[model samples]
Target: MRANSKEQIIEAAGVVFERYGFKKTTMDDIAYAAGKGKSSLYYYFKNKEEVFEAVVAHEAEHLVNEINASINVSKPAVEKLRSYVNIRMKRFVQRGNLATALNDNFLATFSFIEKIRNNYRDIEIDMIGEIIKEGIEKNEFKPVDTNFIAEAILTCMIGFEVPLLTKSNATDESVEKINNVIDMFFYGICT
Candidate 1:
């Protein structure tokens, strides 16, 4: 199949998969959703799983690129980490389905989504570890378990998004709470 055809199917699949969800959606559903025939879908994707993976992978790549670009190596470690959190939350809003799938239902099962999530997460963690290394070099962030600290910060960022999708824009109070949590991550609450 042509590159454009494959991309169209993936784009269509993203909308259909999110609208109908991963389980209820079928190949015919995606084909019809794409305005193409079932054979065309099959020509591009072997199964529903392949289409879903393509959609998720596309979102993941987009997010990684956005976050990576926003990270400034020149900044202080904590400042870099702060920008990382803000950029990540913005992407969470933009990613829509993969974010919803990872944070919401998706047939109430997330092993497949979790695997995809970890693939993206590992990069963020690695980038954070690099910042930690930089901090250690400059005597900024304490020289502790960088990997564990990175994991903690990443978890906090994901936690911030967990409730926002369900609200009419989660309240200022909720945003305040999550920001407080994130701030504690960058700097200890006590001066």
Candidate 2:
């Protein structure tokens, strides 16, 4: 099926892109990995960018799904936040190269990532915003600008992928570091 061919090419692209990054990856590289002639590959995907887009979509959607599945709204915000962070890191590692490529080529990869990010952005923000609202309503957190605070928490998550793979400290320690930074943001050191 052409759909299957598309999937194959996309997976192969993930491998090549991850190994060589966006600038270095070529259509020939993807075709070879996909076990097709470069022209045949073009028959399925217009170019490497199309293949790369497919991989990015698959990997990012997977990560968001895993994070959503792991989050338990019934739990307190603190525990929910912890689970959120854990799920995101775990999913990224599970995704490996696809994950690496997504981060590595964020600015330069297929514009598809921006589209995907835009599509998912609201859902992600709403998820965090809801929790912040609930915590405030429950008196678990002091009343503050929920939206801005939610955005702040989301901003802190920016560090998750970068440090986990590159940091000298144990992976578990990064979670501690994340928690400390989050704690400081939510509850200042004055206490």
| Cα-based TM-score, every candidate | 0.83, 0.76
Model 2 agreement with the true structure over 74-167: per-residue lDDT tens digits: 7887667777767665555454554555466654345666665665556667777877787788888898887887777767776676777665
Error at 28, model 1, angstroms: 2.2
Please give the lDDT score for candidate 1: 0.75
**Which residue pairs come into collision in candidate 1?**
none
Lowest summed-lDDT stretch of 10 residues in model 2?
A: 93-102
Tell me how candidate 2 scores on lDDT.
0.72
**TM-score, predicted candidate 1 vs. hidden true structure:** 0.83
| Candidate 2 similarity to native, TM-score | 0.76
- Identify the leading candidate in terms of lDDT: 1
**Colliding pairs, model 2:** none
Worst 10 residues of 1 by lDDT: 166-175
Error of 1 at 78 (Å): 2.4
83-124 in candidate 1: lDDT tens per residue?
666666766655466686667554337466667767867987
